[model samples]
Target: MNCDLNIYCDESTHLPNDNQPFMVLGAIVCPVNKTSEANSRLRELRIKHGLPAYFEIKWNKISPAKVDFYLDVVDYFFDDDDLEFRTVVAGKEFLDHDHFDQTHDDWYYKMMFLLIRNVVPSPGQAFIYLDKKDTRGGEKVRKLHEVIANSIYDFDRRSIRRLQIVESHHVALLQLSDLLLGGVNYANRGLNSSSAKRRVLNRMQERAGITLTKSTLLSETKFNIFCWQPRGNRP
Candidate 1:
């Protein structure tokens, strides 16, 4: 089975006790054949902005000095039709894990499923790469693979070919995922600490034609957002 698509995923402020009220999980979906070209353009963008080729595009690293470059990167993503993004944002302040009979990790896996469930096309195949978070992340990766594969009934694992953890710096697309996910996280958190970050987020909002804080139509292919609302009574 040929995996025609590649999905690079990243998460921001997802820790259960990170003191952050919101968490964002996101993925960059790109055609396998266009991956090389996409990376090439990103590299070019970096060089064009006087950044080293090896410099990673990280949202946290954005500053007034580099705002223009980051804004261009945002535009590049939207200009390229082959690139698409989808994210799941959750407000974690009121989660009742005990009442739900599940751990935070379990809910995390469910969020992962929500992020990609609708992005996978019918009769299409994809390989998922997640940014490595910690030492135990390998185990989480395996479990997430199981959750997704089972959800789609891909018992043979053909439709969802593989799921693995990768270092963000090693994968250009993963870094891009981090930037895009960061914007959603920042917007949802209602932060204004960084003018540079706000500038970048404004560019993204303008290009996508939607406020990042709210959920976009699921059918919105270019920049899809799902604001997950937790249900059920608390214990």
Candidate 2:
């Protein structure tokens, strides 16, 4: 009965007409077993880096400066081995003002899928946490969760043991990570008439050599479109 715990956090921005790129950022963290040498190493590394006491390293307060210190600690301990932590930042550009009529669900799903694929967790027990997109008991948030769940379930049944989605405003760690990785995305946005949306599309094509089709663009817009679905009995 080995308990392996993993957590995932993501952030998304949906703005129309604004040149600012819509971005999603995600991060994964795994806690090594307490008895293992990894735990001891983590503690030692924290001490070496002169970071705040272990208990004080909460997620909400982690800024770029803190991340720098933490990564220094991580490098000290796990530099030799291939550590599993990862951060993903995805950006989508908006060209047409009319495109807002479409939805962003597909892009969200695709980004999550990409993140999951990179993490490649084992079949052991795992817990997933998502920053809540909807508050005030909104129906749209409920429907988005269902779509996300169905997509993941379709990809791998029983891939995760439990999933918890809560408001990002309440989760300090998710908020910190989102701010850090999302900053990079914002910096990459196009200037003036140029936009991150266009750059994202171009980068995708150049890296993957997959040209964006009119249908794909329309579909992505459709996915981004707003919709409210009630979270009745679906889990």
Candidate 3:
């Protein structure tokens, strides 16, 4: 396993009773080799777009002109020819309307499974950065990691090997990435119910020309959202 491959995971939500899809979990995995370049590009983008360094931009704050600028930044940085990003969206239905359930856990686990399966990283180090959640701290993450390890063990059919799940609150780069993804989520939300929007799904198929499998309920659920793989690295 090589010491590379950092997976940045984040979720987006529209909030209560809006009838619009509110939550999305996106993972942007890049090779360690490109981290520096990505960061540099992000810094340049921040300057070019005049967005605050640590602040998150919401739809209401962005006018049409600013939206154009923001999209340009996405095209500039995310359109890179050397990196790949995998996004997972968990809509309100997946979570049972914000309440946790076995079904929800199954959906969450399946999403994680799909994300990792898509990456298919070789025997190398993998870093998973999850956005803070209620069960994200202390025993919860630990248990979640345990569940992931067990799942990996079953998937690999061998003893669990290498993987790291870390909780981070102060990583500015990740925060910026989260904001960028949020913007994408926001822009993509179209005529779907206010509780959930299918824009991202539509955009991904439209832009990337990648069709998701319908056999899987998750894929079907995400059909309305856009999902993309970053340009360069595998998995």
Candidate 4:
């Protein structure tokens, strides 16, 4: 990717039929200059935990045995000055596909745009990677990519260029995004059953000094969040 910034995107509880109260779209923004360093460091952190080079990280995999390792990863995210996390979460309470004049599929990309729009610097190139989770496969992924580029008026392909659906297992940074999104989703959804999960949530809360369930300052670069209201639907 001929870009200066790499964004690893992921979402939690974002299915159309899921009973979850919220759908969160999150991205881990890393500077291109540090992309290799970030991935190398994350893989090294995995090795420190005895995880193999091919190990894939995910939120559902959080367990008591590996809680400490997960905690360290969370800390590493904040400790690393080059990494940033941001998300756009939407409440499903007033979700009306018809009212929004779009299908859930369309809304998914719209949320993706919202998640990245505020962070992508103008007059620069960036590559966006989303977890390969779309139901309609490659075509949908391609369309979302074009939609993002078009939204930014990058019709000439000079600014934001690449958008691809990648398997999270192969991309360590993508997995990090997933873990971060999962933590926020768990807390905001009031899931208190998993102690390991709660511990991560507590750590995140301590780091931000705010409810993991609420939005942080818009200028908060380290851990930023935006809560999308029910009536707020894109054109």
Tens-digit lDDT string for candidate 2 (1-235): 2345555566545433445554545553544342244445555655765763353333234454555554443243234232233343444542322344434555555556555443435545555677665553345444444555565563453555556676655543444345433433443443223243334334433432333221122123101111212223224
C-alpha TM-scores of all predictions: 0.96, 0.48, 0.61, 0.92
RMSD of each: 1.8, 10.9, 8.7, 2.9
Q: For residues 1-235, what per-residue lDDT tens digits would candidate 3 score against the true structure?
A: 1335776666666243546553455566667787778777766666677765533433234444465544544465346754555555444533342343345455555555555554534666566666665544555455445666666563552332434344334553455446445545654454343222233333334444444321223332222234433223222
What TM-score does structure 2 among the candidates reach? 0.48
Choose 1 or 3, whichever is better by lDDT: 1
lDDT of 1: 0.90
Q: If both were scored by TM-score, which would come out higher, candidate 1 or candidate 3? A: 1
Instruction: Estimate, for each residue in 1-235, the C-alpha lDDT of model 1 and write its tens digit.
Output: 1238899999988999999988899999999899999999999999999999868999999999999999999999999999999999988878988988999999999999999887665687888999988898779988998899999888888888878888999899999999999999998888999999999999999999988999988779889999986786433
* Model 2, position 114: C-alpha lDDT score: 50
Looking at candidate 4, the ten consecutive residues that score lowest on lDDT are 226-235
CA shift at 121, candidate 4, in angstroms?
Answer: 2.3
By lDDT: ranked, best first:
1, 4, 3, 2
- Model 1: which ten-residue window has the lowest total lDDT? 226-235
- Point out where model 3 deviates above 4 Å: 1-3, 14-23, 52-61, 90-103, 154-189, 192-235
Better of 1 and 2 by TM-score: 1
Among the numbered candidates, top lDDT falls to 1
**lDDT: the better of candidates 3 and 4:** 4
Flag the better candidate by lDDT, 1 or 4: 1
- Local distance difference test values of all predictions, in order: 0.90, 0.43, 0.50, 0.83
